[model samples]
Target chain A: MRPLPPTQRPNWRYIAAEMVPRWCPASARDMHYAILGCEASLFGDSNAASMRTSVISCDGGVVIVRCIRGTEDDVETALATVTDVGVAPVALHPFVTSGTIHGLKKKIVIRSLPSDEGNYKIGDNTYRILRMSGQKVDLVQQGIKQTTALYLNTDDLEDF
Target chain B: MRQFPADTNYSFLPQGRFVMKTADACIYPYPVGDASLRRLADELELRGFTGAIAVGIPAGCTVGNVRFLSGVDITANSVKSCRDALRSAPKTDVVMVHAGDAVFNRAILGNIPLHILRGIYHTDKRAFDHVSARMAADRGVAVDIDLSRIISESGSRRQRTLERYREISRLSRKYGFMLTISSGGRSLVGLRSVRAFVLLGAVAGLDELQVCEALAAPAALMSPHLSVEVIE
Candidate 1:
């Protein structure tokens, strides 16, 4: 391969950030994850506790989240609230389909996936990820769709 | 681990370890673009995932053509560059590389490490497509690809999906790659799926933690993480 011309030499900063860490955090990295989005929030239901609907500007998209963990009611009602409501009536989430077995009691079987993308921190040492899961079920009327739910796996929202 | 009782909400893994097949992470190229990556990450987060999606693209192509979905914190957009980086890294450091490509006119199989392949997926689409296709054509590389979890989440007819998998499996196996049963939750994988292929059982479905009695003693013989005491 030929050497890059001075003009064509690409910036190392983009590549450095892309491949490996070039900068260290001011403090030790603590692994923590956030619960984002709910079916309820998708439909413009705003009063879902401490969770707020916001978007990260670096990458643009609106998400349902809590700047800090909220109340249990906040978590309960708001978790997985951003579901697709207009389309169907009784579809189960994907986790349910993936792990749970349905019966009279709506029983589910969930296996912990070793790594959840929701759980990560660049310069931190902690390991946390939102407990995102899915279950599959067919509605007698509407059809099949994935129902999603979220939870705080860390102490940040454990009280909630 | 114990067998999961049907009604229990928390199911036990076949053994209590995450299955380590890199293929378990193989994803189709369409969803890895900028905006989509972030949404995908959020969706994965809401669903409780920690690993990065192995976004495969065709190789030797411009970076922009690959539509990178935005949700991920750090995308590994360089399978091509990792090799150059690795040649100069420390001896113990892992370099990203795929197993096999370039055989006779007929495609063959090669041993690209799973983690390396996973990293490459984040690069450009053409690079990924070329890599997978070349593996199919030259080295018989098989892509156990899938639509993004979002697409899987998006509603679709079961029959249509089943047909799609069947076709994809046929294509992969035709050129010398095996197709694994993924996407659908808890599928009924039977002896029937492995009919004519030159492959074996689903690597993803196996109990990852289960080991033969023989290799067990040796790892225990080693120090640190690999070391485990034998129990009667």
Candidate 2:
């Protein structure tokens, strides 16, 4: 079989998305499936299949998604629909879209890991601080079935 | 690529305040979820929002540069109950009612105190019709298109939501009723960026300009009470 010429090949666009919470451990494969699932649900099977979306790479809390050039808008819209991967609730927000992977990479804001801020108590339950970046803090309250994620800020912490 | 830094204080500066024209009309902060109003304001700033209406929080305060307006949501099952709820609803910047049946919607749209009609996605298919749409337009009551349901729901549920939103979008185009966009976020992670809302709005058949106008509608809703001053 012979490879097609560059002009004959399908043009692709890359999108850079950052997973919320900064602690979601979903890998590139997980992100790929999540995007596919969201696209399928939002655009239906035929439209989603025609989009030809895939995960190019995952670094830290960011994932680079590649899709057929003209379908960038559809892909970005689908990415907004993805609320979770596996059982962990998360949000994948696309920050930039570009024709070249190099250009997309340059536009990706470098994500940093959330550091331990401190512990806080509200009423009867006690929560442990999971991730703190700037004014926002992510707290985890252990429940019977799953952990409850509490998103708060420094001012709220001070009130406690 | 326009993501703001985590600590970016969108407008809460002592020297100068950058008031954002765009605001999320509705979000439930703390008690509903662990995210406090201040945290939600900060998250909105990081996501490019300059102001928001917190359902349970006190109105008229600026947190981290993002203007915070108080709002009250009435979850009633009937028109009479909705009217009663409105009568008792605490004084806030915005008052919204969850959509019910067609009769309920028509009755509530004409209410002078109602500022917004929300939660149309889960209502009956005929809940909001041409009559209600016309009434809303005439009354200047905005219809809220919540993106949180579109973002969180899937399968048949998501399809139904999109269908409802499409119907509302079509009606708004024809009737020229005001439309408001909200995340209906319960936590910080649930908040979305303006671009995200615009893209999600497209999924519901809203154009870019429509989405931008919807985002800015909340600010306009609050300006009607401003005192007039002579510019001369």
Candidate 3:
């Protein structure tokens, strides 16, 4: 089949979203299906089909969701409804929207945190620092399923 | 344009008018979750919120660019008990009550000095009817739309919540009652960005401006003495 002309092709919009608990092991496929499921559930199959939502990339805790130009808001609404992918509970927090994949990628700043994990204590209970970005610090209780994560900042750790 | 008294909490634009501050009306920190007050404030600032109402915390605390308001949630079996709870509760930034039966809602809307009526999704279908919505509008009490349930719940429960919210949005438009949007977040992970709330509002059939106004409602309610100037 011959490629459709530019005028015939649907205009696309890319939305950049950060997954909460950035360390969660959710793959691109998981995110794609989760987004599609959410869109279908919220807008029904017809509207979801019209939107043409897809997860183009999920790299380093950030996922770029691609959708038709006019349906970016609907896609965002669906993203907000996606509380989990499979059994892992996570949130897709969208920060920016752009017309091109290159433009979306340019706006996303992927910080490189210290590779080595650190330890911290709070009221006799010890927690290992899972990921530190800016003032936000993700912590995991010393012994648990690792599913339970603590979201705290540097100031909160001052007393301990 | 509306009028607001000059205060340090409000930023004064070059036009000599107050800039409506976006605030997340409800958040649970510390004992309720691992997130501390400072951490919550930091998260709010990052999410583009100028202020937030932290349930059970005192008002007048500022961290970074975000300010904290004390919010008290009253849950009672009857109107009399509700009144007693209100009287005993100290002066706070925002007063929110859990929605009750139809009669209870009407009674609270008229008699109480409440800022927000919350948890409507959990109540009976007839809890907040047209009469209650009118009372809320006349009394200047905002109806709280908690998005946390919509985010976390699924299947029938989530559908019910969405239906309830859609009805509330319709009522708000018809009766002119204010709507306040809250993340109802217990931790940083549960909190949402401003744009996210606006999109969620769209899902409930609300326009972007309505959601922005709702985000600004808590701040205006906190300053009862000043008139709220909602930006277009």
lDDT values for all models? 0.24, 0.82, 0.80
Q: Which 10-residue window in model 2 chain B sums to the lowest lDDT?
A: B9-18
Better of 2 and 3 by lDDT: 2
> Per-residue CA lDDT of candidate 2, range B1-232, in tens?
6755556553443423335478898888988866887777777876888988788875567876688877999999877788788788778879988988998888777754688899999998898989999888777789999999999988888889989999999999999888999999887667888888999999888998889889888877765443456998
Q: Candidate 1, DockQ to 2 decimals?
A: 0.02
lDDT of 2: 0.82
- Off by more than 4 A, model 1: A1-83, A86-91, A94-151, A155-160, B1-23, B26-142, B149-167, B179-232
Residue B51 in candidate 1 has what lDDT?
22
Local accuracy of candidate 1 as per-residue lDDT tens digits, B1-232: 1122222222211222222222123322222321122223222333323222223332211111111111111122244433444444333211223322223111112333221221221233233333354454343223332322212232333224334444434444344332322121111010011110111111112121211211121111111132256999
Can you tell me the CAPRI class of model 2? medium
Per-residue lDDT over A123-152 for candidate 3, one digit per residue giving the tens place of the 0 to 100 score: 776777864555566777644444666776
Better of 1 and 3 by lDDT: 3
Residues A1-160, model 1: lDDT tens digits = 9998966742211000000000111111110111233423221345433344222111011111223222323332222222222321111121111111122114222344323344343233333343322321111111145221222222222322
Poorly placed runs, candidate 3 (over 4 Å): A1-9, A123-125, A142-146, B1-20, B87-91, B225-232
Question: What's the i-RMS for candidate 2 in angstroms?
Answer: 2.1
- List, residue by residue over B89-122, the lDDT tens digit for candidate 3: 8878788999989988998888888899999998
For each model, chain A TM-score?
Answer: 0.20, 0.87, 0.85
Please tell me which predicted candidate would have the highest lDDT against the true structure: 2
